[model samples]
Target: MADDSDLEKTEPASGRRLEQAREEGQVPQSRELATFILLIVGVTALYVLGRWGGHRLMHMLRTGLSFERAQAFDATGMIIALYDVAMEGLMTVAPLLIALVMATLVAPFVMGGWVFSTNILRFDLSRLNPMQGLGRMFSTHGLAELVKASLKAAVVGGVGTWVVWRERDHLFGLMLQPLEASMDEFASLVLFATLLIISSLALLAAIDVPYQLWEYHRKLRMSKEELRQESKEQEGDPQIKARIRAAQREMSRKRMMAQVPKADVVVTNPTHYAVALKYDPEKSGAPVVVAKGMDIMAQSIRELAKEHGVPILEAPPLARALYANCELDQQIPAALYTVVAEVMAWVFQLNHWIAEGGLPPEQPGSLAVPPGLDPAAGDPEAAR
Candidate 1:
C-alpha cells in the first residue's frame, strides 16, 4: 500500500510545498560540489601565496634551527623562539585557511541558497530505530550515494596514479639536483597533482549537482490526493467558505434593517421591493438609501419603519430603481435626484403637519423615476 501511494505521486511539488519543505530544512545539497569549491579555492590560494609562504617558512626554519648557544641554555629564550616559529607558521598559512573558510560558507548557496531553519535540530526517536536505519541504508537514494562515492574514489585514485607516473622522471631527477632546484620542482609537481585532482572533482560535482536537484524534487512530488488536501489547507474547505459567506450576508442584512428606523421615508413596491431613504441637507447634498431589500426583507423593513413612525410611500418604479441601482448608505443615482427631492419635501411637510395637529400633507404624486433606472421596465418578463 505504501509502495502504491509512492508510485501515485506524479505531480511536481507546488511552490507552497517547496517553501514548507525548506522551512523543515529539507533542501537539495551536493557534498561533492561543496568539496570541489573548497578544493578549488584552497589550490588558488596556495598558487597565489606559494612564493611568499616558502620564503617565510624557510626563514622560520633557519631561525629556529640556528638559535644562539645562550638562548638554547635559557628556558625563557627557548620559549620565545618557539613562539616566534609558531607565529610565522600561522601567518604563512593564514591566507589559505581564510580562503577555505570563505569557500565553506559559500558552497551551500551554489544550489539551495541560504536557509536558516531550526526544525532539523529537534531530536527524533525514529532516527534511532534500527529497522528504519537499515531501511534508509538500503534505499534508492542510499544506493545512488554509494555509487557516487565509488566513482569518486576511482577517479581520485586514477588521477593520483597518472600524476605519479607522469612525474616519475622529475621525481628521480630531483635527488641529483641542488636543494633549491629540487624544492622548486617539488612545488611544481604538487601544484600539477592538485590541479588534476580539482579537475576530477569538478567533473563529479557537475554530475552530482543536477542529480541532487532531481532527487530532491522527486522526493517532494505530490500525489493527486495529497495535492487536493494541500489545496484545501491553503484555500479553505469550499463548504465551510460558503457557510461563512452566508453568515456574512446575514449579518449585513441585519445591519441594513437596523437603519430602517432612522430613515426619513420608506419607498415601496408595496409587496416586492422597499428602499428606506435618509436625507440630511447639512451632511449630504442628496438623499441616501440607508436600507433596501426585496420580498421578506422588504416586509421586515416596512414593519420596522411602521414601528418607528417613518413614512411609507408607495412608489413601485422608484422603489425598484433604488433597490436595483443604489447601494446601501450611498446617494441615490443623479438621474433620480429631482424625484427624490420631491419625496424628501413631502416627508418634511408630513412631519410638520403631524406635530402641529393640522391636515396631513399630500403624498408625492407620479415620482418621475427614469426608465433606465428602473430594472423592471427593461425586463420583458417582469413587464408582462
Candidate 2:
C-alpha cells in the first residue's frame, strides 16, 4: 500500500515545497561523493609531502633515540626531550590535517551546498521507534544503500588484493634489501594501491551523485490531491475571495454616491442611467465624470443630486455614452467634446440665472454624442 501511494505521487514538487524541505534540513547528499573528495585531497597531500614527512620522522626518531646519557638521567631533561619529539610529530602531520579540514568544508558544496538548519538538532521520538527503524532498514532506500556499500567494499578490496598479489615477489625482496631502500619501495607501493582504491571510489561517486538527486526529487513528488490543496492554500478560498470582492464593490459604490452631490450637473437616462459631471476651469479644461451608475444606483445618485440642488438634465444618448465610455474622475472623450462643451455652456448659464434671479437659462438642445459611443445607440427605446 505504501509503495502504491509513492507511485501515485506523479506531480513534481513545487518551488515552495522544495524551499520548505531545505529549511527543514532535508537535502540530497551522497556519502560516497564526500568520501571521494576527502580521500582525493588526502591522497594529493600525501603524494606531494610524503617524502618530506618521512625524512622528518626519521630525523626525529634518530634524535629521540640518541638522547644524551646525562639528559636521560635527569627527569626534567627527559621530559623536555619527550616534548621535543611530540612537537616534531605534530609539525610533520599538521599539513595533512589542514588539507583534510579544508576538504571537509568544501565537500558539501558539491552536493546540497552549505545548510545551517537547526531543525536537524531537535530530538524526535520517532527516531527511537523500533518498528519504524525496522521498516526503514528493510525499505528500498536501505537496500540500495546496502548494495552500494557492498559494491564499494568489493571494489576497494579487489584492487588491494590485486596490488598485493602483483607485488608479491617485490614485497618479499624488500625485506632482504637495506631498510632505507625498502622503505622507499614500500611507500611507492602503498601510494599506488591507494590511488587504485580512490579510482574505484570515483566511479562509485559518479553513479551515486545522480542517484541521490533522483531519489531526493522522487520522494518530494506531490500527489494530485496534495497539489490541489497546496494551490488552494496559496490562492485562498474562492468563496472568501468573492465576499471580499463584493465588499470592495460596495465601498466603491458608496464613495461614488458621495461625489454625486458635488457634481455640477447630473446627466440621466431619466430612469435607467445617471452620470454626474463636474467641471473645474482651473483643474480641467473638459468636464470629468465624477459618478455614474445604472438602475437602483442611478436612482440613488439622482435623488442625492436633487437633494443637493444640482441640475438634472434628461439626455438619454449622452448619459448612456458617458456611462459606458467614461471612467470616474476622468475627462470625457475627445470625440464627444463638442456635445459636452454645449452642456457645460448651459451649466454656466443656469448657475448665473439662479444667482441673479433672471428667467431660467434654456438647457442645451439635443446634445448629440458620437456614434458607437452610446452603449444603446441603435435601440429605439433608448433613443426615446
Candidate 3:
C-alpha cells in the first residue's frame, strides 16, 4: 500500500518555510549556534592577551602603590581603581561581541547560500480568513515547531548541567579568595565558560547547515503534476502536433501535383509506383526525375499526369529504380541513360508518326540503342 504522503504530491516550500521557521523561533536558535562559536574563539584569544597585559600592569601598580611617596601613589591610583578595571574589561570583551555580530550576519549564507526568491512573501486573500489561518497555525507544522522547541530545551539543559558540574570546584574556591583576586579569577573563569559554550553551539550549527541545505533541495523537487504542466507548456498538445503534420503533408502533395504538368513522361509499376521525368535539351542532356512516390502518393501522381495529358508508360523496373535512387528535381543515373533514351525516342516517334498520319514503330528491346548514340560516351549531363 502507498503511504498517504506518497499518494499526495509534496509541494515545494517556496521560501515560506524560512519565514515560518523565523516566526516559530527556529531562526534565532540557528543563528545563535554560529554566533556562539565565533564569540568563543574571539573571546578566548582576546582574554589570553588581555590577561597577560593586565597582569604586568597590575604588578607594576602594586609595586608602585607600596612606596610611601605621594607621587608614586598618585601615579598608580587610576590603574588600581574599580572603574578603570571595568573599562579595561569592556575593551577586552568588545571584540567578542563584534565577532558574534559578524558571524550572525554571515550565518544564513554559510547555511543556505544566496537564495533571494520572493515567492513566500505573497499572501492569498483566501488565507486571510481567521478560521483558516488559525487551523493552519495548529497544523502538522505546529507539531514540528513543538518538537523543535523540545529538542532545543534538551540541548541547552544538558550543556548547562555539564558546565555547572565542571566549574563547581572553581566556583566554590572563589568564595575563599580575596576580593580583587577573586574578581580576576571570576572574570577569567566566565570567559572560559563562555568560550566552551560557544564552541559546542558552533559544532551543532556546522552539522545543521548541511542538513538544512539538503532539506531545501528535497523540498524543491518537482511533483508529477508540475512536471506534466511544464511539459505541456514547452511542447503544446499532441493532437495539435498531429494536425500541423497533416496540413504540411497536404501542402507538399499539392506542390508535387503542380510539378507533374511540366514533366516530359511518367513511368509506373502499373498501379503501385509512379515517377515523373523531365528533360531539357539546353539545360539537361539526361532526363531529370521531377517526382516519384509509392502507394497513395503514387496514385496522386498518376491522376495528376492523366489530368495534364502526359504519357504514362508501364515499366516496373524503371519505376522502382527511379523511386529508390532518385530524389525530386535530380538528373537520372548515367547507367540507365540508354534505356531512358530509347523510351524517349519511342515517345517522340509515336508523336511524330501520329502527326504525319502513319503507324508508330514497335516498342524496342532493353538491349537496343539508337543510331549515332555511343553507350560508353557518358551522359551529356555528366559532360556539362
Candidate 4:
C-alpha cells in the first residue's frame, strides 16, 4: 500500500514543497546545458586567444633569443628572465582559464540560484545496501538518464564525424600549402568542428531543459493524502482552529462585561443598543467607550451594568450612535463629545443628589444628541 501510494502521487508540487526541495539541494538542472555553455565559452576563448596568442608567442621567442650571454651567466639575471617567461605564459592563458571556471560555476545557478545544503553529506545506510543500489541502477529514472546520455553521445559523434568528413578535402589540401598557412587553416578547421559540436550540444540542452523541469516536478509530486496533510500543516487543524476562535470570542465577551462596572453610566435604547462610557482626565481627552454591543449582547451588557449598580440611562440616539461608530475601549468620535459631556455632567449631578439624601436631581431634559452622529438618525435609508 505504501509503495502504491507513492506511485499514486500525481498532483503538482506546491511552492512550499519546491522551496523545501531546493533547500535540500534538489533542483532542475541539465548536464547538457552546462556542457553546451562551457563548449561555447571554450570556442570563444580559443578564437580570441588564437588572434592575439601568435603575436604574444612571437614576442616571447624574440625576447628569449635576444637575451645576452652576460645575463645568462649571472644567476640573478637568469632567475629574473625565467620568472618573466613564466609570468608571460600565465598571463597569455589566464583569460581562457577564467572563462572555463566561470562557465562551470554559473551553470547550476541558472535555474535555482545558489543553494548550499548539507543533505548530501548525511550518511544513509540504504545507499550502501547492494540490493538498493542495484534497484536504483535499474530504476525508471536511472534508465531514462542512461538513454538520454546515449542519445547525446550519438548526436555529438554524428555531428563531429560529418564536420570532419566535410572538412577532409580542405584538410588534405593544407599539406600542399606553406607551413604557417597550413597551421592557420588547421586551427580554423578545428574551430569550425568545435562550433558544430557545440551546436549539437545546444540542441540537446534545449530538449533537456524542459525534460529536467518535468522530471523534478514529477519526483516532488504529492499524493491526495499528502496534499491534505500539507494543507493541514499550513492552515492548522480546522477543529482546533474553530475552538481557538470560540475561546477568543469568549475572552473578549468577558473583558467587555468586566468594563461595564467601571463605566460611569451605560446609555441604552432599552432593548436594542447599549454603550458603556468611562471618562478619566488622566487617561483620555474625551469620554471613551469601555464596552458597546447590540441586540442580545446589548441586553447582556445592560443586565451586567444593572447588577453592578452602574447607572443606565435610556438614550436611543446616543446608544445607536455609540454602537454604530465606537469600538470597544476606544474614545467616541469628536463630533459626539459635546453630547456625551452633557450626559456625564447630568449623571454626576444625579449621583451627588442621591448621595446627600436630597431629592434626586431633575432628570436631564432634551439631551443634545448630535444630529447625524447616530446611524439610526444619520442614515436616511434606515429611517425609511
List clash counts for every candidate, in order: 0, 0, 0, 0
Lowest summed lDDT across 10 adjacent residues in model 1 is found at: 375-384
The sequence of per-residue lDDT tens digits that candidate 2 reaches over residues 185-291 is 99999889998888889999999999999999999999998988888899977888999999999999888888998899999998789999998989998889999
Candidate 4 per-residue lDDT over residues 1-384, each given as its tens digit: 646876899799998899899889898888888888899898888888885875676567667667877887899988888889878877887898999999989978886566788997899999999998888898877897798789878977887788779888988999999766777888887787778778778888898889888888988999888888899899999998999999999999999888999999999886788899999989988898999887899899999998998889887877888888899888889888777888999889877977887777665566656677667775544432
Q: Which residue pairs in model 4 clash with each other?
A: none
Better of 2 and 4 by TM-score: 2
Model 4 C-alpha lDDT versus the unseen true structure? 0.84
By TM-score: ranked, best first:
1, 2, 4, 3
Q: Give candidate 1's error at residue 303 in angstroms.
A: 5.2
In candidate 2, position 172 carries an lDDT of 95
lDDT per residue (tens digit) for residues 270-365 in model 3: 667789998898998789988888878888889889998787877766676677667888888777787888778877886687689677777645
For candidate 2, give the lDDT of residue 233: 93
- Winning candidate number (TM-score): 1
TM-score of each: 0.87, 0.86, 0.59, 0.81
lDDT of each: 0.89, 0.91, 0.67, 0.84
**Which residue runs does candidate 4 get wrong by more than 4 Å?**
1-3, 51-93, 163-179, 366-368, 377-384
Best by lDDT: 2
Model 3 weakest 10-residue run by lDDT: 375-384
